[model samples]
Target: MAEQTQPADMSRWPLVIAGGFFLIMLAIFVVAFIVLSGEDTGMDADDITETAYMDIVTPLLVDADPERGREHFQRYGCTACHGNQNLAPAVDVMIASAGERRPPMQAVAYIYESIIYPGAFVVPGYQNNMPRTYSDTIDEAHLGDLIAFLSGVEAEPAPEIPEDDPLSIETPSGDDATDADEEFALSADGNVILTPALIREYEDLAEFLLAGANPERGPELVIEYGCSVCHGDLAAGILAAGYAEMGQMAAERRPPLSAAAYLYEAIIYPRRNTVEGWDDNMPDDYAEMISTVDLGDIIAYLLTYADE
Candidate 1:
């Protein structure tokens, strides 16, 4: 007589369906948010322009400039061996065959590999005579620009970053252990390799080397080499506060360095004696960018800030 059974429960079906619809809407919203955020930055893995390593500027692959690359090619003396020198395949020839050199490797990537790792894929009958130190010596941060030029793509350079945006140097301040100048110092000419061995040899430098240098040319060098990128536009009255009176201020800031000597050290090894309240983000490659004569000129120009 007790055959009681439960009726099919219809009450919970609407609740389950509502929950399922809510989850679907949430998922769609999340996907849309992600897509929009990514596109807002307009950056890809290859287009990332950040300087978190080695105080070098790694520009986006898409922002490469062929004209800039040509300047580097000629400035670096590629003609010495490749083109007119005829020791190896001309750069044009190599660039033309870049796509074919390494199967499946993109032409731009192949060109970049050739510059960075010349031995990555060598052409037959052409001994790998390209100097391996290019990555270290040249402004390799913009090597992609050179690669684009070689590949004949001629992409426009990355647009000038506004003052409000992240600087060409996107790295956080004081994050790089290598930028610290505690264990190493650069030579006078800025050509010396900085090593951490027990003994590091530095050139005996003069206290004042402004005698024969042309200070007039210093400003041009500063802008041309992109020092203005971090330091600001000197012509527009935009200058570092510490550098306002860097000549007289230099000695007090860095004792016993002599104003000129300190300037030399600062240019070659910026973080060697960083000024208070300033980030140690300046690239310590100024020495390589200028000649001894040119360095003297820059120092001479900087000394004028003392008189001002």
Candidate 2:
């Protein structure tokens, strides 16, 4: 049997095996990071596209309506940061500072750039954390509306919302809606006035507790609750928003309502805002089976998928 020994390369087999295992683990970690970071709110600076540049700002700009802009300033929840909170500068202040920060750029153009691409030019002393995809989130026609308002230009008659008004709240009329809106108030203009009270109110909404839910439980609940039946990858569902992803979207899904409120309402009041492609097929009795605490947990769990 002529020594009957292994080849020299055989000595490297253990290293080769360990290296292969390490590569597999690295690939899995990479996949997970990609999946985790892939939730797109369309707000990244990188979200800017040529389409945005190609968009004719002139049409919206030329016809910008300050009054409408003023209205949208509230409607899109722009006030959350820009209002007395002053997380961002006042529109008038922005207009003045914009010219000095980036000269020959024209204050209006600079303002436009700041909006869709806020990272392009940071305000003198402010954090460069403004969302960069406002154009994607708002109506195209309203760009001029916002710009006109930012510039303090004169106004013309405003137009109706091309999309839902973020400041307004709507739900199916029923017992649940009563419970849901008990703490909320509407302005004379019919917009829900979000206040610090809303935060307090949301905290006390029940025991299910989305505020501090362990999101790890969300996927299990979806399967346990049969949400996976329709919204799951294996199911033939409408709305296309799978359970976990829906939590990420819950906030923007129905504005005026916080993410917790929207999730609660969507579960309890499925008859409202029926998805266009389907009849209101979501069972209305989920609230009966799921405890309020679990409901909060479920929402908390779902939101785990959302970006920070």
- Best prediction by TM-score: 2
**Per-model lDDT:** 0.56, 0.60
The true-versus-predicted C-alpha distance at residue 139 of model 1, in Å, is 4.0
Candidate 1 segments exceeding 4 Å error = 1-142, 145-204, 234-239
- Could you tell me the C-alpha RMSD of candidate 1 in Å? 18.9
In candidate 2, what are the lDDT values of residues 1-308, reduced to their tens digit? Answer: 53347676876788899999999999999998887788664446566543444355556687777776776665444553564324568655654565566665555566677777677777766766465446555666667878777755663333332233422423334453333455545556442455666545543573346556677777787767656645778433432467666767777865666677766667764534444444334554465567766677777776666655
Please, what is the TM-score per model? Answer: 0.37, 0.40
Q: List, residue by residue over 1-308, the lDDT tens digit for candidate 1.
A: 23235344665677799999999999999999999998986655455322221122234355667766654554444533554324567655766686787766667766766776677667788776665656665655357667776776743443222222212222222432234344344445332233433111222353335667787887776655545434534312222443355665765654444567667777775644455554334455555566777778777777778776
TM-score of 1: 0.37
